[model samples]
Target chain A: MAVEVQYYVLLSMALFSIGLFGILTRRNALLFLMSVELMLNAANINLIAFAFYHGNLTGQVFALFTMALAAAEVAIGLGILLVLYRNFRDVDVTVPTTMRW
Target chain B: MIYEQIAFALFAFITLASALGVVLLREPWHSALMLGVALLSIAVHFVMQAAEFVAMMQVLVYVGGGLILITFAVMLTEREDATDDTETNADEVVQT
Candidate 1:
């Protein structure tokens, strides 16, 4: 049997769950960032796959916008991480409450 | 039937493996590098699905812009300590 669109969707979901797990469990600040990227990529894959399956340009366009937003997010996030590291001399995110909330 | 299935399986494996590597690796820098590889592979997969524009944008925006920003973030954050790492692991960073 040939591979189907649903297979891709399932893979995307599985990858998304793994990324979520990483985000929930990992303590390293950078690894946490990568996990967030992984989740975003999972959503992108689903969008693009559906775009292909449906023969439309919408999903792809959405993915492009998503990529743009992700870029902006990382830029701001990195700036904050830089300052946080400087203030605390560490990047562990557990102490965020003492600093912010 | 079998050959097509094999190819599809290979592509799936490559994608899943790299995605997993992004989380599994110990070093933050290596994880970012692997994430780039995963994004590039995803771009190729998009091409396979006949999404030429998405594929190109994936390369240009994701690999070019996103990955570069991530690497720069890693470089700017100077957390040299390997121990005492604990995190909240919540607060999913989302725009909007």
Candidate 2:
């Protein structure tokens, strides 16, 4: 039997939900960055699945762009995390309360 | 057809489990390892779906580049004493 597109969609949804849960519940800055990566992968999965199902390359192209963006995001995010660690000696999300107003 | 189904099931199971591990593991290094597993599984899924270019790109970009970045971040930011305290604090918050 051929694998239907819906199965891929379901898998993507499951991954996205797990990532969302991690982002919402995790307090560590690194975990938060990891969750965002998970979410990006979920999106990439959906994009490539649909691209294959539709017999086109647009989704694949977009997925490549998404990967580039994700790389840049991780770079900037980690840079910020490094600075945050240097400043506060911790990467806890709750520790950066200087601008809490 | 059956083989394809089996492959999909296997890859999906691995990807999901490792993704969960990424979020659930207490140690950041372990989580990073799980993330690598999840990314590889996703690359396999891409190959199964007949997106060879995307699959290779996934391996290159995420497994090669992203994993290295995460490792560097983990190494650069890690402090033994502070990590223990942070782990305890995070665990307590998670438990509640």
What candidate 1 gets wrong by more than 4 Å, as runs, is A99-101, B1-4, B83-96
- For model 2, how does the per-residue alpha-carbon lDDT over A31-82 read when each residue is reduced to its tens digit? 8999999999999999999998999999999999999999999999999999
Could you tell me which residue pairs clash in candidate 1?
A: none
Q: What TM-score is obtained by chain A of candidate 2?
A: 0.97
lDDT (0-100) at residue B20 of candidate 2? 96
Q: Candidate 2 chain A: minimum summed lDDT over ten consecutive residues — where? A: A89-98
The digit string of per-residue lDDT tens for model 2 on B20-82 reads 998888888899999999999999989987889888988998889988998988888786575
Best by TM-score: 2
lDDT of candidate 1 at residue B65, scale 0 to 100: 85
